[model samples]
Target: MDTDRVRLCFYRLLQLFSTCAAFSLVASLGTGMGAVSHWSMFIWCFCFVITLITFIVQLGEYQPSLPFSGKSFLFTYACLATAFCLSASIMYAITYIQFLPHGPFRDQAAAAAAFSCIACVLYALEGAFLWLLFPETTFYFATIHGLFKLLETSVACIIFAFISNTSLHQHQPALVWCVAVYSICFTLGAVAMLLKLVKFESRLHTFFPHFLLGQTMLSVLLYASALVLWPLYQFNEEFGGQPQRSSDVSCSDELPSTLCIWDQKLTVAILTAINLLIHVADMAYWIHFIFIRSRASAITGL
Candidate 1:
């Protein structure tokens, strides 16, 4: 027990250090920020704050005082943190670090992105260690379906970040429908995750699995439509989109800062396809699980 406590404490401290270092590096960059920088900064600050609170809570062994299961809370937090940090690192690096002139600012930005990745890995490791340590502890999000839920939502979030204020869906009903599909599926997955975290899914018993399966099926259909419509509209010349990327000067500017609209469109399409695949896998798992469950029940009845 003492050894376990030491291990957890060391792990938490490492997470805290990485997050804090990332946030501080970003904060020290006093000027010339853009939308991506602001978003990355927000992620770093959020991670730092939450990690600090969690470290304190765990150190004090205050899990029993929380309204929800502490293990569930930690598991969920680690998963989300890993996703958020990875997204931040990727976005900040691609949008800022990759474009900045090789200098102190670029160095700092690169270091910050590196720290964010370190934090992401640490959080993922923490989640894995927790699972190995407490295999018996049940959290719906810890299941395969639940992990899919996390992936779907996380991917949707990155897609949203890429498209926000960019007007990638404007002036076309097809693109608008794609946006709607993303919103609906993201909401469904997010709400299901929230319910599980709050232990509300337990109240519904068998109904919860059906609910999950239904929503996953709905998401799969929605994403399939999005997968088809998004690329077709964005890449099809009939929709005023070029079949090939244009050589716009702004896209290749010396200080290419923000993501070009073309890049955003392509990214959204790719992420849409990826999320569609995840939802399909999620649907398949639930279907198989439900079928096996029913078969077992029928055998027991006989």
Candidate 2:
């Protein structure tokens, strides 16, 4: 009815359409494309369902009945959808589209990738619109710390997807350790985000900040170890791993049906390094907050 609501509705509709189109394309392919296709399908379907539910809740004015703030829920979900859909698009393109021969399959995969990308952009726009149009609240994800937590979780999800093939980590104890590190950090990050979402942080004072600082420090150390170990175990010749991508048959061959172990290993290693950097940055922020900013605030009585 109002302009803001109207705009919101428009964005939701576009997101729904794009996600639907993307998934439909994937579904039409009938599962021949392998893990990437299934992963892409899951992302698209998840986004579509969540968007539909959020749209319905907003339209029906059911915010009061919900456990969380509806605006915060929508904004957070939009950010998540954008990250997931973007990853899905990229994964689908990298694993399938580039390898598929020129044919109907290739066209369908490309179309799905395009639609996924469109949906990702729409969700980003929706999140931005909500942020700009509404007054800022104390939503945890809106803060820099919260956003970094979300990024860490999202990147972990992508790494998980890439490493879904057991061949990359199977029989390799070091790579398994990297997976454990990812799991630990991802679990901690998700729990932190959920606590903030449920407003549990407000109930605690110094403990939560201290918890965050500890969590980040632990995450940094874990990821740093994983960053070095993953590449070392994956690329080192002495480890029975290929020294170059071209040396790996799956990666060197053209038009492979699925992503090669080399690619997955490299992707996991690269993402591990990126997440290591993110954790480092997060650690620095928490250290500064716990030591400098909080002390200054207490001293000034602000």
Candidate 3:
């Protein structure tokens, strides 16, 4: 198979894994499953950003834009690839601990853990692919992404464990802790992207647009999953025991646990369905794109 084709598959599959993980995360977060808050709250924000970028890229293809640059696209790709890998690894650990043969979400946790692992592998491959394509700068993106994610995931685990304690009253100033950590991570991700957005806009198409054609579709899936999670609550039962939302990860006086019940199992299901569709669409698009390009080159060579 062509390198492009392989990348197509890797990305689409990563989308599926990412989406399913998001679903479980959404449901888990919304309902505050197990000892942790739902994974959706903090994560959905990142997913939304990813979706927006994907949409912008899609629009750029049809309508052309001053922002189209090979360097920029490569940078965007690197940042996302970094996030995806980190999310996969952390999510795997979180779900594993959440279920742990001793928790109520065992089945869901197991499935999610598997997806996270696979997604992690794909992103690692993606990082490698990009390294080969642009060996000089891959390290910068990877390191930045890794540092951010390491902080995000590690803090999340600590925060989740802290909140999961049934004796929430003991963890004084819980609200402050959660808010501070989440704010820091959010700021880091945003600053990194803002810097990149500026860079992409400045540079022309130093990168081949065709290289990423049909590629941004998977991000759409993530966007869809993120959107659907906001109002869709099918897993309300899991919300009872969790700490109050300091909006998402911490407890506050404003929103009591009594009001935190939001089940998004249906949202998870929808994301899974979308993942299947993404996989199929990716396969179809890349095959067509590659074959057509190959044929054109063959004819042109004569």
Task: Provide TM-scores for the models.
Answer: 0.88, 0.92, 0.44
Q: Local distance difference test, per candidate? A: 0.84, 0.85, 0.43
Residue runs of model 1 more than 4 Å from their true location after superposition: 1-3, 30-34, 59-62, 139-141, 247-249, 252-255
lDDT of model 3 at residue 6? 57
lDDT of 2 by residue, 1-302 (tens): 89999999999999999999999998888766766568778889989998899899889988899777777788888888989999999888888788788999889889999999999999999888888878756556688997898789788988988776778888799889988999999998888877777777778876988988888899998998998888888899898777898888877666688788788888888888888888889988988888896788789996
**For model 3, how does the per-residue alpha-carbon lDDT over 236-287 read when each residue is reduced to its tens digit?**
3243222222334322334333222222222223433443344345445545
Residues 137-206 of candidate 1 have per-residue lDDT tens digits of 9866677877898888788878877766446778789888988898999889888888888888779988
Give the top-scoring candidate (lDDT): 2
Q: Candidate 3: which stretches are off by over 4 Å?
A: 1-6, 21-37, 40-105, 136-139, 142-178, 181-189, 200-302
Q: In model 1, what are the clashing residue pairs, if there are any? A: none
Model 2 scores a TM of 0.92
What is the Å distance of residue 267 in model 1 from its true position?
A: 1.2
Locate the minimum summed-lDDT window of 10 residues in model 1: 246-255
